[model samples]
Target: MVRVTGNEASMVLVMGVTGSGKSRFVNLLRGGSVEEGDGLMSVTQECQIVRVKIGSELAYVVDTPGFDDTTRSDADIFEEITTFLATQYASGLALKGITFLHRITDVRMQGSTLSTMTMFKELCGDHALKSVVLLTTFWDKLSDKSIGARRQQELRQEFWLDMTAKGSQVRRFDGSRDMAEALVMRLVDRPPVVLQIQRDIMQQGKRLEDTGVGRKIATRLDRSLEEKDKELEDLEKQISKASKRRSSRDLKQLEERLGRKLTERERIYASRQKLKASLGPEINAKVEKQQKSSPIMDKIQFFASILGMTVSVTTNIVLPLLGVAF
Candidate 1:
């Protein structure tokens, strides 16, 4: 039981879509099988924690369900994550880093992949992004080796530009335990940070629906419903056209599917409403304050550390070489 003893252990959240190698990544770190699945089915259902020792200190890794999950609703996934984070925060656990697993083989970032990244950033907020590591996986699966470098370069420029500019580190995971540990160890040694969602739901006593990320989640749900409505409308028009051709079987099946889809959407919306239940007024003054102040402080601190390292290198190596030459 690698319990956190007064913030000594760093808790890291493993995030990404299905088959992005999140469970495999953490399994390597903890030397345990976390039930990795295949072929469009989600393996991990909810958030599970595996604790391992990094050096002399214990650290914990949380494996979360991915986006586009076949079995679970988006609302369910979001709620599960929010509750787990809030529980950890209440237990005095502080997150030191978050690892976003992405497949190097994914040549393009659009659709669900892009939306997943957006939700992740919204969850982390700008303040906590400094501790994020966008760990790209499946390096060993590159069939054409030359293309891997090109794809990674594209990801850096096109996909990860803004987050990288905000102090997030990017690294390659080569399907090795040592590689995963090396990536995580760099973060576990750093100072702990409370994510914006954690701070809002814990310190300020706000509901999950009231937090900035929570509100973002709600907005996402709204957009999803709107999209689903459009999809249903299109299906209805198609069904109407198919009726003229006596394609009753397929049209009826499609209508049934749309009806079920609409019901699911309504269920998710109702779940949010039930959870909301007037959990007090939305008071996130502290979260707003941090958002305004953190970026400037973080940039200054980042540059200062770099300058210090450059000075150290000059004194330790460059100056000695110059002296010998003189």
Candidate 2:
């Protein structure tokens, strides 16, 4: 059991079933390169910690062996995760939250997946309430709009509803490069206990020396904090400007735009109804006529009719195929 001796940062354990892209998720979390070897085939046999420094906050992204491993008993896996958490806590590490990653491409949520999640909550006690985020991964695989929409709906209906019911934060995440950056930013802004731990580490380091290793570490941390603060200030300014713009906008213009859009929609719907009514009988008659004909004979006759029509039209013209083959 590895003990966290000092002010350990918050740990975000990235966990899910085998082939659910846990390692890839961890790589994304750490802003590291996700290589070809990083697949669903168990890249991590044990718990591995990747530390990231984001604006003076230390975000420890923990990657554990895939849950729902066929070789490992369910009880064994659950105990392992619990033991890892216990060790972290014992070592003075703050539990930030657990990102229960599920692949978007999963046809259905497995029973084992749900069981592990429940076990995690049970192990964490009340601390799990605020720290859990059911992070759905592999969103890139859901490129088809219709399929992606259905998958998202299923997740919301099946998993997110229950998670929210249990007072857990549930969010869908695309494990793409661009989305990874956004996720990191979000983690920094809403840091778990790990950020506090990082601050403690930096503070302690700063007190040691004015130059050398301590000074370099302190300077880097300070710079990160300053950058984060600046970003927050800019975001606040943008929000304020947006709010002011919204307030200044004319209500009458909005109302008029809404009315116009409604009127246009109504007109289009009415025209479509009218057209459908007019074409209904003709279309039905044609369909019935075709349906009454024998399938093979109909196609034969259809081609025959076209050939005959062409010949008759040509016969009436000059040269007329030498007056019907002389």
Candidate 3:
């Protein structure tokens, strides 16, 4: 386990839906214990950062909370994740790459799983696809190897077609430490790219809700609220019928369900409010302050590094504009 004092280390974000083996994958790299969720309930409620020595480079592997969390709404998960990414980006910490894990044993991709993938794409944007790795795990658990192979092909042909076409790599994780290290080393060796969400927050000065992923989340929340309202309405009618029939047990169950749904609705409302809150202004302020204090060359280098442009391009194009001879 390699430890670093500063936060300037290259970062790799690991993400997927619940039960996708994200934490386990991180543990493999760190060679230490990271709390793994039991069955499908998400144990990683927040981002857990682990430091590892990938060859000569010290990298931070961030295990993020999975969507479909039992205790939190999807909106809550989204806000928590985006806030971390925005803060890191503003602080000049660019991700080396992103690894998205999926369970090969899953018979088919559920709606929530598909939504998570779509949200991830929106979060990373097209420019950052070259720095992403799509990983399918749980191959060791598959009794029949052909089943896993078929699912992998399906993902390649249908779900992952766009990402692969855009320069993302798709690889099967064999649940080995050697494989984990190899994957992470591949990422840390590449040039760091700024994710679209990061650019939206820091450069565009856009509110979280105005970001592409944020807007997608808002749409999902609105749809969830609508569905919850319909559920509550149906429950109300059922409760009324049960009460009229003097069925205490049925009425009690209906009332209980209604109460639970109402609580869930409130959580959704809270997430919506969190989404509307503006995080861009504060980050932009920090950026402004940093730019003011730094020298011209330093600023140029800083921007060039985070913007994912090559040093040669920055030297040739950007320096020329400032009347600086190379």
Model 3: per-residue Cα lDDT over 1-326, one tens digit each:
11223334577899999999999998876554468865888898887667676555667678889877878877788777877787667656657899999999999989989988988999999999988888999999999999999999999999999999998888888887777777777787788899998888777877778988788888878889999999999999999999999999999999999999999999888888787867778655655655666533332244333333322110001111121111
Model number with the top lDDT: 3
TM-scores, all candidates, are 0.72, 0.50, 0.78
Clashing pairs in 2: 4-91, 9-194, 10-194, 19-40
- For candidate 1, list the clashing residue pairs, or say none: none
- Tens-digit lDDT track of model 1 for 238-293: 88888888988988898898888788778767756644632222222332343345
lDDT per residue (tens digit) for residues 1-326 in model 2: 22223333444667767777777766654444233234545555556666655444555566777555655433334334434443343234455566667777777767766655554444444434555566776767766757766876887777667656655665667555344434443443444443222221232222212313223333434555456555556555655665668853554454455465555445434322322122223323443454355233322123223223111110001111111110
Clashing pairs in 3: none
What's the candidate order when arranged by decreasing TM-score?
3, 1, 2
Q: 129, model 1: CA deviation in Å?
A: 1.4
Give the winner by lDDT: 1 or 3.
Answer: 3
Q: How many clashes would you count in candidate 1?
A: 0
